[model samples]
Target: MIRGDLHELNRISWNAATVRHNSHKQDQAGFLRSGGSTLFPEEIELLGEIRGKEVLHLLCNSGQDTLSIAKLGAKVTGVDISDEAIDFARKLSSDSGIVGSFERSDVYPWLEAAIAAGRQFDVVFCSYGALCWLSDLAHWMRDVAAVLKPGGRFVCMEFHPVAMIFDEEGVPKYDYQMPEPLHWDTGISDYVGDSGGALAVSGAENVSEPFVNPNPCAEFPYSVSGIIGAVLDAGLELRIFREHLFSNGWKPYRRMAELPGRRWTMPEGMPKIPLMYGLVAVKS
Candidate 1:
C-alpha cells in the first residue's frame, strides 16, 4: 500500500530528474548514443518502421526517442512531468528541425484530458525507467487504451524489474535503503550508480545535474506476467513480447552468449538470467 507521505517524495523525484535533464545535455546525449541498436532504437524497430505513423510517447524523457521517431516521418508528441526536459526537447527539436510536439504535464492529468476528449493515436510509446515511476499501473494502462485508436499499437521497452532485484555485486535481493522508495531507488538494497556499481555518475560533477529525491516511491517488481497483465487489463491484445539477455542498446549485457551480434557468450560457468523485456500490444 502506498503511504500518503509518498506524494511529496514523488514530486521531489520528478523535480530532481528535471534538474538533471536541464543540466546534463551531454550526459543525456551520451545515454542516447545516437545511431545504432541501443534499447530505444531496438525497441522502436521492433514496432516495425514507424514511417508516417502517429505516435504518442508517455514519460518521454528529454524527447530523444520521440524526436528520433519524428525524424522517421512519424508525427510524435512527447509528454513528461519534467518541465526542464520538455524545454530541452523543444530546443533539440527546433535545432534539428524535427516536427515534434511536447507536453509538460503529469501523465495522469494529460491522459485524463485525452480520454475525456476521446483523443487517440496510432501508436502509444514508452520506454526506459518509465513504468516504475508511475503510482498506478491499471490507470496507466487505461490511459494507453484511452488514447489508442482501434487496432492502434502500444509499445514499451523497460528495464526488467528482475534487474531491480540485483545488487552491485549482481546478487538478487530487495529491501530499499529507506522507508519508502526514493526517486533514485532501484528497489534494491543499495545504490548501483548509473552503469552498474562500477561506474559512478552522480551530481553535476559526474552528470549534468545532481539527482536528488526527498521521497522515493516504491517499485513493485514486474515479472513478464505482471507486465502482460497490465497490457491485457488496459484492453490490449498481446501481439509480441520479447525477453532477451542481450541488447546492443544497453551495452552492459553485450557479451552474453544468448544475445545477438557478439561471438562471446556468458562466462563459461555463469548463471543464465533475464535482464529485460520488450513488449508490444495492440488495442483491439
Candidate 2:
C-alpha cells in the first residue's frame, strides 16, 4: 500500500483505540485525572526543568502526557494524526483546567509546518510505542531536528525493538531486524485496559463496544542502531541511551510480575530482557 493509504489505515485504527483509551478507567487519562503523570521518573530527570519552556509532543495521543508536562509550567503543544484522539485530548485538557494546545496532524507534516513557520521549541518529546508508527526514521528525525532550536533536547522513550520481536508467549516470532513495514489485518484492540480485545469503530460517539476491523494496519520496526543512528544523522548529539527492564504497561506479555512504581517485568527466572529504552539527544 502507498504511504498515504497506510497512514489512513493506521489513523483509523488509532482513532478506534483512542475512543477506548479515553474512557478506560486505568488508562493515561484516568491516571492524569488522578494527578499522576504518565511520564517515567527517568524522563522527568532527563527533561530537567521546563518552567516556561516550550515543548512539542509528537503523536501525543489523548493529551495525557502533554497536560502532565504542562503541569510542570511548560507551554506545550500536542500533535496527533487521529482527529478523535485530538478532540478527546482537548476536552481532557479543558476539563482538567490544564493549558495545552492540541492539533490533529501527522507528525512529519506537522513538523514540516512548524519548521516553515519558524516555530522552534526547547524540547521535542515522544514516548512509548511512538517511533514504530513511523515508516522512515531518518527523515522523521530530520524533521524533529528542524522543529527544535539549536541545543534543544529530543527525548524518546519507547518499547525496545528487541522486545517487540517476541510474541506474547515469550517466543521469538518476528525478525530482530525488520527492514520493511509489517501489516496486520486483524481487528485492532485497545493496548491498555481490556488488553487483547478488539474494538469497533463507527459513526457513533462514546462507543463502549468492541468491533472487528475489516482493514489492515501497518507498523515499521527499527533496531537500536537504526533508532540512534537516525538521531545522529539528523545532527542531534546523543546524550543518553538507557534501557529499562520494566515496561510502562503490561500489554506485551501474556503474564508478568508486578513491580514497584506500577511497572511490570517478566516473571522471575525469565532472563532479564530490555523491555523499553530511552534516548536523550540534543540538536547542535
Candidate 3:
C-alpha cells in the first residue's frame, strides 16, 4: 500500500530483474532438464511429508523451486508478480518436462481472489528474499490465513532480518523493528549465480557488467519477532521458528565461506549470527 503504483512499478522492476538474474545462471535450463532441484536441504527437511499435498508457493519467482516442489510429488501451483518470470516458468516447465501451474499477479490482489474463490491449499510455502517486497505484513498474514485450510501449514525460509540490518561495511544501520521502506533504482543483483563456477549458456548471451533497472522497487524489512507476531495475530499457531547460520545461493557478506550444496556461511573467527531462518505455522 505504501509504494505508489505498487502493481505496475514492482512488476516492471521484477520483470527486468528476472531476465537479468537468470542470464547469469549459465545453462540453467540444462540443470533443470537433468532433473535438478533448486531447493536447499533446510527446505526439504522442514517441508516433510508434502507428497500428494496441495501446495501453494507465493512469490515463486521463475518456478525453479516451484518445479522442484512438484518433483517432490506434490501438486504445486506457483504465483508471482512478474509476467516475464511466469512466462519463463511455463517455458521451463515445458522444456524440463515438469508439470506445474503458474499465475502472474500481484500477491495482495491474487490472495484476495483466491480467498473469494474458496481456493485453499494444504501448505503455503515461500522462501528467501520473498517477504521484503510486501509493505503490509499484517494484512499479508491475514490473507495467508484466509487461503489456508484448517490444519494447513505456512512454511517460510527467509533471510533473517537480523542479518539484513547490517550495511555493506558491517554496520547495523537498519532497525530491528520494521524499518522504513527502501526504494532502489539500481535493481536486483545476480546474487544466485554470482558465487562462481556458473556454467556458460550455449546460446547467444550477453552479460551486463552491472545490471541496472529502468523501474524502481521498494523493500520493507521486518524483525524476527515482528514476523512471528504477524503469523500469530493472523490466527496461525507458530509451530516452529528455527534460525540458521548459512544462506542458500545468495551470499550476504564478502567474508562468508561456501558450504556444500551452494550454501554460504560465516568463516571461522567471525561472530556467529543467524543469517536465515525456517518458520512453520499452522492454521488452528
Listed in order, each prediction's TM-score against the native is 0.75, 0.90, 0.91
Which runs of model 2 end up more than 4 angstroms from their true locations? Answer: 26-34, 194-215
Question: Candidate 3 has what TM-score?
Answer: 0.91
Give the per-residue lDDT of model 2 (tens digit) for 161-233.
9898888788889999976788988635655543322111111233345656554689988999899899999
**RMSD of candidate 3 to true structure, Å:** 2.7
Candidates ranked by lDDT? 3, 2, 1
Q: Candidate 3: which stretches are off by over 4 Å?
A: 1-4, 197-208
True-structure lDDT of candidate 3: 0.82
Put down candidate 3 lDDT per residue, 139-251, tens digits, no spaces.
Answer: 99999999999999999999999898777555678767654777777656555444443222222245436555777877888888789999999999998999998877676
Candidate 1 weakest ten by summed lDDT: 187-196
Ranked candidates (TM-score, high to low): 3, 2, 1
Clashing residue pairs found in predicted model 1: 9-215, 24-208, 38-249, 39-249, 181-216, 181-217, 182-216, 203-210, 257-265
Write the residue-wise lDDT of candidate 1 on 1-284 in tens digits.
43334434555555555554445334434443344222344575666877888899998866777877776678999998766668888887776666799998778878899899988899999886777667667778978888999989998877666655555455555642223443446221111123222222221234322344443544444556667887898889998877655333332342334433321223456675555678889988
Cα RMSD, each candidate: 5.6, 4.4, 2.7
Overall lDDT per candidate, in order of appearance: 0.63, 0.79, 0.82
